[model samples]
Target: MPAADWRMARFAPHRTAVSSAQVETVVARAVGIFGLVFAAQTVPVALEQSEALAVGAGTTLMALLYGGVVALAVASIGKVAVTGTAAAFAVLYAAALAAWPLLVDDPAALGGPPWLYYLANVATSAAAIAFPLAASVAYTVLVPAWYGVLRATAPGGQADTLLATLDALYAMILGFVVLIIITMLRQASRAVDGAQDAALRRYDVAARQHANEIERVRIDALVHDSVLTTLLSAAAAETPEEQRLAARMARDAVRRLDEAGASGPRTVESVGLTVLVRRIRAALTTFAAPFTVRVVNAAGVELTVEAIEAVYSATVQAMVNSLQHADEAGRTTRRELRVRGVGTGGVVVEVADNGRGFALQDVPNERLGLRVSIEERMAGAGGTAVVTSWPGEGTTVTIAWPAGVDGATT
Candidate 1:
């Protein structure tokens, strides 16, 4: 069969698309953006007025401090362990925000009470999705708290203590807002993945249940058409010759029961065309009328156990009917069974007999031997059976499997 049909037969399970990009990617990008923002805005402000911020603190130390944050971000971008590096950077960045005041060389570089610089850290910490919501909120609050402490304790910061406290509270509130928003999106993604997985599981369960129902129906039909027919024939015996025929029918019933038990629904597989034909011939040995079997253009093709059983049982029933009814005038009948492989991996078999045939429409629905036994049984196995007859020509029962049904699907 084609690749497309095979995929339709077997489907892959659901998986989360969110995991395609690792969580580390989010952390790296956030850190990279934060570092860029810091370098672009704060670096110039700190070094303005002829490197005023680096007066007491050497330019080398200030440059190294900014470079450190950038280095951590860059390091986390590579194949390094994500959670460890992110945690380490987040923890140390808190310290860096706290130590900014100590690194200020000129008093003028304290630049707006020195406490408000931590606002930028709040935004950066908010971007760290790897951190738990609580941890992120804590980091947001911690950065500002460190700034507040240093500013309140600094010599000239005593009068601006209230302003420093307000800055810290503002940063804490904004940090939590960012955390909640990101957390909600993450939860939504997880919920979507869960729903998709649940739906796929339900589909698998439904498919299994449907297959089981079909199997049950097929088994019931086989029992009705094959088993009951034999029993009826055995019960109707009248003479020594008839008794022998009935005994053969009884033995056929026993053999069919054994085959049914041995070839269980779960353990069966696709059988070779020749093997199936041989089995059919053996199955019909009990029939009083002899049937010649032939195979044509059927090399390297296979039939599903279900399809095989369906065709075999239905064809046997057809032959039995022909022997019993086709030659009502007491004339010799000729029976032919043909199996062929045609099209793309397709199977076609015909049970044709050279006997007086009856009109098709005259068969009643009450007699389920043809409809239920042959037609319904074949349909269940994903195949079709068609019967044609006339007053002069013999009846032909054709059984076929579609072009792409290569074998039984387990």
Candidate 2:
């Protein structure tokens, strides 16, 4: 069987029980009404045959049974597990009906036609279907068969047989109608459940997206608080060196802010890598004095919006590091920032500074500018940023991000 069918089958017993209970409650009320009617008919017959022992005894028994069944059905309202009780009541009702004929002088003269008794029999038999499988089969088939045998020996045997056939047909039609109604109700319930499930899933997705956006905003706020404010304060420092350092830090923080503001590539379409590269190079020159930018094979490179933002941010960080730490203002003419397209697969952005470079090993562990902003950001964007620097030699910061052969970033 298919997986869904198997699952539904496993759940069917519980669903059946619930549905059966509902059916039983409705059927019970109907049966109670029928029982009341039957008991009432017995009243006049008992009055007319006041001295007949069999008639009086049968009338009393039927009245008591009908009253009891009515009480039981009323008490079991909204309860589905009363199938067995309902079945017992059905048996009692059938037994009472059979004995009722014997109570009157002429059973056919009691009320209506003899066919009415058959109609009542058919209605009672149809009520049996509300019970669980075993009880329903026993009451529906066996009780009717028992009645058939008893009726066969009666004086108006042909009439009883005809009534029985009509009742049987009525029972079948009633069963079919009940089945169709129940089926339609079940289908409607399932459709409502499916719609609710879909609505919940959509809510979950929206919640997750909102949480991500909030986190991004938080990160941006933290960057502004720690980096941007400090740089702005440093920019107003008395000494030129402190002012330059502050300016560089402020510029770094600003670039980070811009990148953060640009919703990740996941939220947008592709952007040209060449244009992003040129923009980064220009920003670096604007932020730091006398910075030389060289572009080699930077044409025809396109990347996802997020990847582009990541690459741009990393390039800006490299430039900021060169401007702040690289002591090349008095020694070298300018700092070199090279942008290159690596083969047909990726783009490599190299920021090399001829300054008093610090050893990579000597860099402090808590420095988040390189670790968090550069390396972590690149990694999240499915790329890597490498920083290679040693004392007395030039520092080279290279950021590599995936690029399609036709210059598209996935």
Candidate 3:
């Protein structure tokens, strides 16, 4: 198939696609709404059973803890604090359950089930959303069992064994249902995210290949039409005017050819370190963001022109990447460029940024700025590039020529 036709092929839109991060966010909001609704339902029961609770201390503590849960739920709905909110709900609900027996004025006066019983499902649901599978499952079983034990004891109105068992089972079942739903949604969303990332990586490789092919075709056409025409005109010239025209066309063709070869591979030739540094300094001025430059002991050092160009290009690409991505919220980022001579013949260039960084492995394979432009370019020129970064800490890109030498000055 023709490269142009393949490149033109349409890709289907992902109308129904969703990522794990997005699914998690939606689930968190839904759980928040669920908690709020359950809170409302528990209110009427609390009022009906107010006589059962010890007036001042018990009621005040309940209000304080439950109010905190309600605030967390509201924050979740607004997408402010999700993970922390889920955790707080689970912990606070457990505290309330443990304090239930002590808070009651008289267990015998509690003729019916406690109002807290109605919110058992709410507590377990919060646990399911907040904790890991093992912890959530344990909480589901333990909390219900504890409730059942309380029901069969004097402090919990001394209910029959069968009644307590039934109550525990019901709450456990509801908790399990919520756990299953959330687990399945997260698993499916992760699968979708993985598939989308793979697809994008494949597309990136194909697009790069297509661009190379197009450039090759353009260079081939230039050689054939312009170069061939100039040669033919020079051979056919008979008069001084014709000769001058042929000469002018020949010079124009040579200039065009030189432009074409500008991006091609070059033979190794020695160049002074000062020349490379000067070129980089000139390029740095073009960037809008400023970089702190440091140079040390690089006066007399010499390296192959191919290596010099590779290091220069890689350094520029690194600086460009920092400018594009190294941003931290609520803080200013510090960027630096360092160049120094190592050993007698080696050179090193480094670009560092104290900005919001990212895990190297997490970067998509198709991101040519690192994989192709910097790393691959350096490798092709017989040099090495190492990228080090951590999320939030910062990023540093170190480039070294002649492969294995490092004489980096602090």
Give the top-scoring candidate (TM-score).
3
Order of the predicted models by TM-score, top scorer first:
3, 1, 2
Clashing pairs in 3: none
lDDT of 1 by residue, 1-410 (tens): 35475345544432324421234356456655666566566655455422434455535544554665565566556534545655665665566565555655565544445423533453345335557766676677667676666666542244366876886677667666666656665676556545544554464455556556656777788788778887887788789898898788778877877777554443123444544565566667888777887776554565554565677778778887777778757667788888887742568878898788888799898978888888877776667778889987888888777523433221
Clashing pairs in 1: none
Task: State each model's CA lDDT, in order.
Answer: 0.62, 0.58, 0.78
Per model, state how many residue pairs clash.
Answer: 0, 5, 0
Error of 2 at 36 (Å): 6.2
TM-score of every candidate relative to the true structure: 0.42, 0.35, 0.60
Relative to the true structure, candidate 2 reaches a TM of 0.35
Stretches > 4 Å off in candidate 2: 1-56, 76-84, 94-130, 133-138, 141-149, 155-160, 183-410
Q: Please say which candidate is ahead in lDDT: 2 or 3.
A: 3
What local lDDT score does residue 348 receive in model 2, on the 0 to 100 scale? Answer: 77
Query: Candidate 2, after superposition: displacement of residue 199 in Å?
Result: 5.8
The candidate that wins on lDDT is 3
lDDT (10s digit) by residue, model 3, range 261-347 = 666533333545755676688788999989999887675577765677689889999999999999867989999999989865799
